[model samples]
Target: MALDGLDHMELEESKGGSGLRQYYLSKIEELQLTVNEKSQNLRRLQAQRNELNAKVRLLREELQLLQEQGSYVGEVVRAMDKKKVLVKVTPNCRVALRNDSYTLHKILPNKVDPLVSLMMVEKVPDSTYEMIGGLDKQIKEIKEVIELPVKHPELFEALGIAQPKVEWST
Candidate 1:
């Protein structure tokens, strides 16, 4: 019997040959070695990832601490800039006034009385007075009231009073 197409087929196993078994065992060993090398590479990559995560966590904690410290320092600077003003009318009497962040203090002798006065002024144009023509009498009265302190400072001082100072400009 002549087998033309199946001439090259191996019949080692059917013939109980040890050569075929040895070839299969060698292939298995090669595959196991390849698997071990791949597993070691995967472990190295995982360790690198874990180290990066720890560094990120440390940086976040430092940033939070710095922000808290900045707020505390700001509050301390504001407290230091606060102002308190003190005024003394006599040896037994004193007065104080505070502006935004400044303090003013005044002291007077036993025979002299200290008088302090605070005034607020709003600036308006002279044309505004002409526009409100019907308020001529009212405007005059207001002007007199505003000038009373300048015209009679001695009288105000005799009454133990301090007049509000005024400044007018264009």
Candidate 2:
């Protein structure tokens, strides 16, 4: 009877030991899975950070070139999320239209306004322009309708066209 009880105790001990070992093995697997997931997450974030850094570097180079050109490129009226900027563009700026007044434009990477992108992105050094069919006619019309009014206001006045009252207050 004593030998039998001792045998039973050994069996129970073996069972408990095996159960503990299995539990530890499962725990180790869980921890390894968590580590792998964290590593993947880190890699994804690093990739995004690298992309954003590249974009920032490109933007810096563009700003430097604009500064060298001595053109009124525009001012960052507001910066939002490092991705978008509210730019106050002067009338002479390419992004600005006919009016001799400053205008606010929101410039973004992917969601840039069509007109703004046409005026801004076309100035890229690597871009090429295919001449449109009616571009010369459009230019002539623009010169007569917009440039003439601003450059020679007397011509509009002589044609009895009422001009907006411009305040030259400095």
Candidate 3:
């Protein structure tokens, strides 16, 4: 009876050992799956970080382009040779131009300034000064000043004086 009881105890211990092994294996597998899921999430986040870095680099390049400073326009007065030109950029100064800097186009009337472009905008085929009105007094003044000097020269001669000259400028 004592030997039988010892054998029965051995059998119970063996079954308990198998249960503990199964529990350890299930726990280990759960931990391994958790690690795999965290690794996948980390990889996804790293890829998103790389994509955002690329967008930032593109925006930086665009900002640099928008911050550029200077280019000015000037006229070429004369072509000196193939490599240079005389450019008149200021009232009293003349600067040389590069070979590829200037181009020549047909003259277009400058209509940006109304005072400068009054009657000089373009040449009409049939234009007349008759369109101007309300200048009778001004026209008579001009005619008297001009024709009096030519027609009545003796008046000035008799008075021993020269006719007064007038000049008009726009």
Q: Quick one: best TM-score, which candidate?
A: 3
Instruction: For candidate 2, write residues 52-149 as lDDT tens digits.
Output: 99999999999997765232346466667665556665422234222333433322233347787667744535522244454777778867776677
The clash count of every prediction, one per candidate, is 11, 0, 0
Model 3 regions lying over 4 Å from their true place: 1-16, 78-170
lDDT string for model 1 (137-164, tens) is: 8998976677667777787899888788
| Model 2, CA-based lDDT | 0.64
Q: Tell me which residue pairs clash in candidate 3.
A: none
Candidate 2 ranges with C-alpha deviation above 4 Å: 1-16, 69-170
Best by lDDT: 3
2 against 3, candidate with superior TM-score? 3
Where is model 2 poorest over a 10-residue stretch in terms of lDDT?
Answer: 91-100
Q: Report the lDDT of model 1 for residue 124.
A: 45
Better of 1 and 3 by lDDT: 3
TM-score of 3: 0.40
Residue 157's C-alpha lDDT in candidate 1?
Answer: 93
Ranking by TM-score: 3, 2, 1
